[model samples]
Target: MGIYGALSSAVTGLRAQAHSLENISGNIANSQTVGYKRMETSFIDLIPDAPLKSQVPGAVLAQSRATNNLQGDIQTSANETYIALNSTGFFVVEPKVGQSDGNSVFAGSNYFTRRGDFEIDKDGLLVNGAGYYLKGLPIDPGTGNISGSVPEVIKLSNAFLPANATTTINYQANLPQLPKTAAYNSTVYNSELLKIDDFVGGSTTASVTGGDVLVGTNPALAPAGPLTAGTSMTIEVNGAPVVFDFYNGGTYSGSGVGIDLSGGKVLDDVLAEMQTGLRNFGGGAAASATVGLNGAGNLEITLGSDYYGTFEVSGAAGVDMGIATGTASSEPTRPDLTTISADKADAFVANSVSGGAITVYASNGAPVNVQMRWAKVDSAAAGGTDMWQMFYLSDSAATGGAPAWTNIGQDYEFGSNGSLVPPGVPTATINNLTVNGVLIGDVELKHETNGVSQFADVNGTVTVSTLNQTGYGAGEFLSVAITDSGRVVATYSNGERIEMAQVVTAQFNGINSLKRLDGGVYQTTSESGEPIFDLSGSGIIGGALESSNTDISDEFTKLIITQQAYSAGTRIVSTADEMLQEALNMVR
Candidate 1:
């Protein structure tokens, strides 16, 4: 009984060692496999059912212990589609069994894996090296939300992206408080501001004085400081110069040309002096210069006449008093966009400044360049707050009797503080916006609160912060890639990237107890509970892969130990055989 029992125990020991060796060899063999979970050996002692003191250390059994919970070292890959799991989760996948009617037939059997060497196959399906297809929830292209609860095999579409017409344009800009239009000259005072008559044909032309802030002095509107030397202003009436030269106070003040400051001389006295000087000029009578204070406190002069030439105002002040300058013409302007005619398109371009441009799409995927211009129609210096009317090029090549630029049909008004007026409508609709005769449907120009503001910009040009439209031209299918956002994005030829599917990650209650499968995949067992789906992309690393968990040095150590243990078991067998042979000889 002892010899036979010893032999049986030796046999069981050898089998157990062999099983451990098999596990060790597999771990060492798959050391370089991507996402390979190393398998460990667990030994169980099978003692004989006998009295406690008589029970012997009996046979041993070896079992595979899964290291699925142990994470492997994460390595980065150049492929954007490759992904790794940082948490104790697996990627939901399925196997493609057959093809039916030019489509792939899947087994619908859900499997989980950590293998991340997935690449886009010829059929536009993401498949790993193990021949398993990635399963994910489809995402709506318009709403960008996950469409279904159940995960399905992801198959990409290669259809062309349809053209979308311009609907809403998100625009934002800051209008310069003093716009430097093409007609503006910095050396000439008030040249940066707009003149109302420039846009309104046959309208009364206007101008403003720069130097009249009321002080508490008796002549409250007179310049506070005594007139500086060489202070003079010139008004050119049809080539005649009426000069007003300033002199010290109380020294025989002249009303025609030279004027004395203070000494009971008020702002009205200065205007009276300017008016008298204008009357003295030769052709000044033909052009009436009505000089007074507008509502904004700027001394203004209205020029209303049949003068062919311009009524120009230029000056060099001795102090900080604002003076009227810049050439204000009465030539029924077209470049100012006032006397607009179909044949006057060239003049319009010469007056207004560029307000930036964008390309909008038509209904048939046709691209059109929508160019805009900012033309000031009214000004605070002209008895009202600054107002602007925007225009877009409708017909670039319009001939006689045809319209070229069309007004957007709305006015942008600004307060004195460089901001839009109260109850400001930041948004405007460009109704029937036609660019080069391409009738783009009524496109809405959405400008959020404070989107359009009037501020002091030295550039004196519209600064476009955001100018994008919700429209895209047609595009062909391009490529696909994955992101850390846990979404599979497809790129189109139109420089558009759209999310196609959301990768779903799953976890199990007993990760280490899952049944091992071929090609670094696993199956659910009675030990491993049902998979818990994680819609939220947790522990997903994009553009990277997970390396096998097997360590070569550790596997080599275990290999040596198993080999020695098998050898020891063989020695026990040999000893038992020799003893049994001797006992058989004695019995004979």
Candidate 2:
């Protein structure tokens, strides 16, 4: 049949040059990753017998279409959890229970991903190093909402406490003038003289008695020599020593001549012994004595040593006793001797009776009273004195009772109350994330169905489920970011950073009717149509990363056209085995 139709058209050009050199070695092995996106390989031609144009030639090697617009080149990573999606997003990931198998879950239904390298598991679950589970919106441990189902476990909450330290002060008062003394001792008198009588008459009248006399006299009063008429007589001052029945109002009955009534009773018994010696003579013996006044106003003493003679005079008629002896300038002067001084040597010279009471003492001997208010001895005011004005009795209304000296102000402050303990463990949030390179995505195919044979629908039997699960720990991979509502944030190494998964783009009304599977994955066939997810990278870009659509110069020009079509299909089976070996060697 033309040598098997020329070896089936050179094995379809060596399987399209080994699928264009495996997509030019996956676009030079991801050309430095970071959101990589360079994919291309597309071809379509397999029309053998069209409805009415059949010249009957065979050629069928169809469908390849991947050219999803290759874009890759973003690189900025000072890692605030490294992100990169200027437009479009995907990352959804949930179907976990024992990762994939089982008719690939009938090929569809929600397991999309663009790897955003997430992390957080030690129960704070936002997982991804193939530990999957990043699906979003179920936040509410207090309203961080989005709405249910992707949470296999991510809980964090509790931390914030620290603040306190400041307060201290104290003070006291009492000090003014402060000094005093006085306890008891009085007995003063040098001349000690005290006598007053402006004029006193027995049965008589003579009034104009205005007198002033203050005397501590006997500084030996000297001035004697006047009033010597009949040596002054007339003293009947009889209050009880009476026996003088001399009824001679004016006629002393001539006693000096013959009326000497027994010498007038011995001169009234020597004038009653000289008036008892001038009343015990003590003002220096009554100032050198000399006195006379008799006619019964008895008091006739001639004692300048008894005046050189015998004397007898009695009832001699001339009764005028008005005793008088003034002239020392009328005496009055004495009160000068007050000495008490102190300005601290334990000052206290007591006797301030103008409103008493004073105690004061505190160099820690505590005893304050001070209450004087008016005391003056001011001997011409230069400390010969007792000047007082004092005040301070405590109940502190600012030095309390009588506090005026400009109200005493200067000193204050006081306060207290404190206690609380138990602030122990907390300190681990370090290094805080920093990746800076290699982060390509777009390889998320997931499937899990085991209902009839059990990879895990449990009762529906068909088993397999245990691929030794358990990964994602060495500070697990987390960096993925992008939110302004097109969600997909991740970030954990303790500094948390949330919003895990919302991105879901997947559109196909006809990406050449989809289907190419083995790893650069794609599926939806039946003339591809029903996939429309939303976050517009226009329905297909999802945080993008397609890469490897191979074009190393069109795969090295299809590897030189598949090595000349595998050397022309081995020369068409060696020219059909050389024409059947010459017709079987001429029929032998």
Candidate 3:
């Protein structure tokens, strides 16, 4: 019985070693297979029943343990759709069962694999190199979001993408502070008819007589005497001080004032000296203050068209100077450019202009060049409020319409600092705008409150920082690419990149328990837990492939060990047979 038991144990060893050899052979054969996981054979010793102190060594059993958690080397592949997994998750796929109604039907059960060498077949199905179809969630074209939670087989179509109507335009630009135009004359202080500067010099008070203000006798008196020669007076105009000095008989009266108003200065001479002094003071004087005779034959000094403050008198002789008391308050005003007729578009375009041009798409996939012109109609008052009219020119309008330039019926008013003032509404909506028979829908213009501006610029140029529209024309399918988040993006001929679908991954608790199928695919079993589907956050490697996890050197070494063990097992069987034959001979 002991000899027989030894023989049976050696036979079990032979079978176990043969099973190990089969695993090694398969590993060596599939060393270059894509997404292939190496199978490792584990041996267990089966001890026979015996006494408490006597333990009997028995047969061996072989069990296969899959290295499913081990990662494979990622390699680059020429195919664009080929993807590789760098982590523990597997790609959810489906196998084609049969044909139904001339369409490829898929099996109801779900399959998972690391093999991602996928290519579009004739039926637009993304089939992997292992003949399994990839499953993913479809994305909605309108909302650019995933449609549903349940995933289906991803199928691509080469259909034409429809044209989208223009809706919102993100516009940001800097309108020239002082735009250059044909009607713009730098020499002319006030070019516009009803500009703010034109109404700035208005006076509502009566003037003062110089004879009443200058009561001191005109004589050669002491240099430091009051209201006599060498007497100085300071007058403040628009917060700027101007000094006037009386000289002694055509010579400097040793006064500190820089002007030489000698030889009995008249009212005009006093006014001229004050003007020169004011011009040289207060940052070189942006405006001029002058003394002129009004219709009442009274002497009055008017502030400069650019100055916007009251006048005051200071210094030695300011006590007797009645000029500060002879003034009235005035408010700044601007012309309404919107009241102008619609036919004034050509005039506005030709006269006042600083414009920007951009290419926009039409409904029928045609390109339209839109030329926008901002005409500065009225200059700003003391508060920097300037008025500008908006006008547009298109190729279709120029050729077919009666007017070459079309007024958009909009006004942009800028503050003194070149910042755009907010209109009554937040956004400006243009509705039903047709260009070359292509009707554009309601397009909203976004200015960001102060995006458009008008300020002082030496060159008078308007710069557009950004201009983008939401709509796109009809597009033809170009190609498809996958993103890092497992999203499949399809690019088009019209420069539109659309998200078509998102690939999902599946993870299991017992990955080793998965049943291996043909073509590197795995099926779920009761031992393997239910797969958890992940729509996003899967580390998907695009344009690459996963290589086999099997190592050739290790497989070869295992093969050698398996061969030696199998040979030894055969020798044991022969030895057992000889032992039995010797026993039989003794019995004979």
RMSD of 2: 39.7
Residues 1-588, model 2: lDDT tens digits: 355565665566556546755665666575443333444455444545456644444543633445433334444433232233433343444534542543112122444444444455444445544444444443432234555543222222222211111110010111111112132122321111111011111211111111111123221131111212233322211111111232212344432212122322333333343444432331222223344333333333332221111122233232322224321111112232221112211112232221233332222223334332221222111111112222212222332222221101111111111010112111111011111111111111111221101011222111222211111211233455545354555555534455544444555556544554332334566786555655322333223333323345665666576567657656766776787678779979
**Poorest lDDT segment (10 consecutive residues) of candidate 1:** 330-339
Per-residue CA lDDT of model 3 for 1-588, tens digit only, reads 377888898888988988898888888888899999999999999987888678887789999998889988999877678888888889988999999998999876688999988888888888898899999999998888899988799988789988876677777777776676766676654343223232223322211233244334332231222345555666554455556766565656443355544544465555555666655562212255555444443445544554333455554454444444323324323333322233444455546564666556666666665667776644453223466766565333343224455456666777666776655224566555555455665667776767677656677766788788877889999888776678878889999988889999998899999999999989888998999888874778888899999999998888889889989988888988999899999967
Candidate 1 C-alpha lDDT tens digits along 1-588: 398998998898999989888888888888889999988999999988999778889889888889999999999988999999999999999988899998899988899999988898889899999999999999998788999999998888889988889998898888887787777876653455444354345454434345544444444455523345457777665566677787665555544477776565566777667666665562532245665555555555544432123456676651245654564534422234422445766666665667889999998889999998887665665334577878888888888757888778777899998778878866899998888778898999988898988888988788989999988898899888888868999889998888999999999999998888877788998899999999887899999999999999998988899899999999999999999899989977
Query: Where is model 2 more than 4 Å wrong at Cα?
Result: 1-90, 93-108, 111-135, 141-147, 150-554, 568-574, 577-581, 584-588
TM-score winner, 1 or 3: 1
Q: How well does candidate 2 match the true structure in TM-score terms?
A: 0.22
Best by TM-score: 1
For candidate 1, the per-residue lDDT at 497 reads 86
Evaluate all candidate structures by whole-model CA lDDT and list the values in order: 0.77, 0.32, 0.68
TM accuracy, model 1: 0.73
Error of 2 at 540 (Å): 18
